[model samples]
Target: LPFWNKGSHSPSNHVIVAFEAYRQLSQVSIRPMTAISSMANIHEDICATAKRKEAAVIILPFHKHQSLDGSLNNTRNDFRWVNKRVLMLSWNFC
Candidate 1:
């Protein structure tokens, strides 16, 4: 899962092509799982997916991007709350 990956917000075709190249050059299998959910259900959605997949760890979305100056920034502060809720809901797996 891409939790605010460097290119998660980029064009899908760009990301796909990069992944394809990486997969071929490295000869490693890459399976991607993607889902779109409303903000209201985001935490629940992530928790459910993690449980269903029996994931050992859930990388809560950092929801910030690094600037050229090496600083992280995001306009939304509520993302912190959502991240906490996701971690709380998935605590069992940890």
Candidate 2:
């Protein structure tokens, strides 16, 4: 969260960069919603955002990645758990 401070950015600015790319590629308007809550409560925030926005779908980044060497790493198990909770709680995905 320190990266969000002035003179800094979100973890090397990847979040901003990704959202900008999405904004460019998407036909509809898209904005990044950041929730400053504990991981345990992240799913709630996600669901709330979707509901307020009347969004039909909620897309979350996968917690895992495959490297060029075919190694499966960079996994955030907490995010995977949160994603499951989001899909479980959000009726649209149900």
Q: Which tens-of-lDDT digit does each residue in 1-94 have in candidate 2?
A: 3323456555536766665666676855766665577887889888887888877656687888899999888589987898888878886534
Model 1's TM-score against the true structure: 0.55
lDDT tens per residue, model 1, 1-94: 3333554456665666676677777997655567888878888998888788876655555668799999988856667778978878776656
Looking at model 2, the pairs that clash are none
Off by over 4 Å in 1: 1-30, 57-61
Candidate 2, residue 93: how far the Cα is off, in Å: 7.1
The lDDT of each candidate is 0.71, 0.73
TM-score of each: 0.55, 0.61
Clashing pairs in 1: none
- Kindly give the number of clashing pairs for every candidate: 0, 0
